[model samples]
Target: MASTEFDFIIVGGGLSGLVLATRLTEDPDIKVLVIEAGNDLTSDPRVNVPAMWPQLQGTTSDWSFKTVPQKGMGGRMLEVPQGRMLGGSAALNGLNFVVSSKDNIDAWGADLGNGPGWNWEGLSKAFRKAYSLTTSGNIEKEGPVQVTIPEEDTKWPQVWRETFAGLEYDPTGNDDPFSGKNLGAVMRTRSFAGNAYFAQARSRSNLTLWTTTVVEKLVLEPSSTRVTATGVQYTKDSSETKTVNAGREVILTAGTFGSPKLLELSGIGEADLLKSLNIEPVIDNPHVGENLQNHPVCVLSFETDPANEEGFETLDKLTRQDPATLAAAMDAYSQKQRGPLSKTNCNAMAHVPLPGISTEEGKADLARLLNSTSTAAEKGKTPSAFAKKHEAFVHSILTNPRKASDGPDGRFAPPPSVSGDSGGHFTIGVMLSHPLSRGSCHLANTRGELAIDPNHLGHSLDVEILARHVQFLESVLVKSEPLASHIKTKRCAPRPEMGISDANEAKRFVRETAIGASHYTGTCSMMPRELGGVVDPALRVYGCGNLRVCDASIIPLMPRGNPMATVYGVAERAAEIIIAGL
Candidate 1:
């Protein structure tokens, strides 16, 4: 029963936890303690190498969990990997840094009735506050993080740019709210400093980050209805149980899975479920482990001849960029903190609308169809019948862009139609950013450890949306002349049944082989108490006084792009709220 105290006790040492801890400790008078359930980043090479992310997929640095059998995915379980290191998932994810859609943020604010601050204007400030931009290729700050865009000597950047241009999307300023359409340039928001990972930015002077410490419970004060999270009980390296006391608060930043499990283990979840586990309910918050949402992503890989890989070959070489070349780039960055490497990888993203959209309505008619179970019913027919109907539908959607009726900034114009007959081979990676299906995260046992049940592809519509995306890829393969030349064969899971050119067959193929984007969120949602909200507008749990959740779990809906930047932005804002409250 040894006890240690701090002015602020932050759980989990990932991006959110670290950001809050770092900000809190900035004031020398305050003490911040960060307890992590994973290893430190100082010696982890997998975290440092920008090109090694795919290899780290299921490693020890990842909390490699799987979902329950998805009914829409032909009853198959899918891998869900979360970062288990000090930097959290940011340490092991595709380094595509793009701000989420402003529409998504507005929806979140509307849902919470929080007004403008929760909208884009408020979030934009937070994004700038946390990150010091150095685009145009430079590393101005000697901070612990370094972001560089992938080198442009490669063909990938050019091809990506052309594709977006072909779609008629504005290529610059996609990351900035004030910037116009046509956002180009890959965001260089990675933590790479030279050839190594930058761990210092997340590391702080007063923040004591204790890795390999798995929190098992939150000890609350006995008398007050307000949750005085006095301390936490955790297992050290999964071998020993230990308790550490917090003089003031216990903030849970253990991510979607770990955070909710902590709440449940502390008896703060659904009463019936806790009662089933023979644990008495403390807070009776049914939403503690509900509302799980993640991006469902499907990649279409193209195998091209090494000789045809001329332009793209630059990417391979860039991965092996020599010290001299890197040094020169570094010098350029040092001078101005702006260079090619300082930009983001994705240049543009299009929000295509389905048919029957109105320019002034702002309502997403296509999203409705994508979210409709009827689409699934249409796609779920036997393979032969589906392919017959799917092909034409796919072609129409790809060549004709749908504009969101009633977009916040007025309706975006329809994308330029690619020559329906043009040819070239390219893979279309379809990602569903905002999914409606919800799941849950609970403790595996009485001891507090996360049992992540993502329920991936839980709803029929999720599968339908992915199916539509796949159809779009197929259309590109068959319709475009240049794209068609590069395509040797269609490669992916549940390989299309031989000679099964029907729409039904394609639908079946998509249903059987779809995968996830690994962006799990919303297990501990921030909403009003009436809507099964786990935390309030300030991210504090409804019944708990001093405890707060400042990670992706607080996001009520999945954003329309990569979530890392948003996660960082949210953490920054949460830090401000926490500080203001104190």
Candidate 2:
């Protein structure tokens, strides 16, 4: 086993880890070492091509985690496929380069008071600093991460514009929502985050990118104050275990599940759980594995009368029904990188407020339900011990604060998966972006994977929001013109077989159908300690000196859109903070 020391050691070479390493190495005087559990994806086409994103999950590239059976999702064990490689999930992610909403971004300061730097102005600059926009089909000279909004050559783009107009929702024409525009039906901007952030840094001699290295535990020593993270114990290529020391600092960018699991293994979690599991504790931090959050999305299905180029009929059905057709598509893709396989159907989307979409009575009922549960504990309530511990979590989410985007915390976007890999359906999703439900990520042993309890839809408030969103979509999608002329009136999950009619039935339908958006955040949250925050506003773990987390795990709340853009902006801010100290 070879042991090498560095000024800085970053665990997990995913989106945040790569971004931080690239930024830190800019100094050249400082050396950075990155340890990734998965192999480098430098030459993998599945990790590069945006259209192949759906096929990546559960493959060697993904740490295909399965959550404990969730009551909210009808006792189903949903898959949690996190990236395990260099460049990480950033390479395998749904390729939307959306920067979230203005109000949503502002909430980092306005609601949670995460500080001025986390606000939209600061994050917006970071977003700009991270990418160069592109449209032309060029890769060699453009950004390492190219956020592209292709030219209006496709028929679906115009159809979507007219359809949104027909619905009277303003289409924010070419304004680039990344600039702060939150409302409006906007087309997506795509990027491969891993390449955009890490490719250029590959040649830097000061940076050592180590792949297939699993961090076994964090090496820490008790100081007069906080426990100092000295270095780490890791193994490369399975059997060859090695120990490396960090002279300056140890940063945890291993993402939500990884960061928390590492913390638990290193004896920095709730003392009770630690004791129960026979692990000694250095810190009895009750918040380490709590406040796990995700966007529970409900997929809505439709049959397109005249399909787009990347529609299901040309992609899924062709490949499924005929081998010759699949061969032809492969040939076309290989020849010019142009074919139905080169794109996906989820290029356009919309966000709506609860009142704007739901019936007045339904809205009233939702408010009443939230208020009832949100009321002060009764004198004799005797709630569950966990509920008592997370009272702050419940109160904080009632405001849906960090997700304080203009809407009623609802987002609808297209995902390629439901667009049918074998038939005549194109699917869109209605996601409760700021769900009130909470879960946890714990560890049994160092070798066992994280015991995840995403507890999806555990809170009834999310069910109301999802049901209303679906009801609104059902009312508008096929009944109206433009989109009406295109989509056939049908349901996929909440189909006629599901018997979904009343509010209760709809809620039940949601329980059985909702799937994760995979945007996990808040395990090592950045709120006050009482509110179950694992890290301080500065992204430092509460009692770990010289140790900080610069990943999605520190996000107190999931943004009102996909969390990827927000992750990039946050990482940029983190780099700035880390550099200032140096």
> Which residue ranges in model 1 land beyond 4 Å of their true spot?
137-146, 167-189, 192-205, 238-240, 305-309, 312-352, 355-427, 447-451, 477-503
Worst 10 residues of 1 by lDDT: 406-415
Model 1 quality (TM-score): 0.78
lDDT of 2 by residue, 211-308 (tens): 88899989989877768888999987777666899998999999989999999988899898888777789888988878788888877666565454
lDDT of each: 0.60, 0.69
Model 1 RMSD in Å is 8.7
lDDT of 2 at 182: 37
Q: How well is each residue in 1-582 modelled by candidate 1, as lDDT tens digits?
A: 246677788888887887777678877777788888777764454554443455577878788887777776778888888888877888777665556666567666553555566788787677656554455655444323444344454454444445445545444432332231222333333462211222443455555767788787888765554656788887775677777887777899988888888888888888988988887888887777777777666545443334465553322122345566567656655565444344432332444443223332313544454445432344321132222232323323322444221111100011112112122223445666555456677776775545566666666655555555566555543334433333345542235332224546655765665577777777787767665578888888887778888899888766656577778778888978888987
TM-score against native, each model:
0.78, 0.87
Index of the highest-lDDT prediction = 2
Alpha-carbon error at 460 in model 2, in Å? 1.1
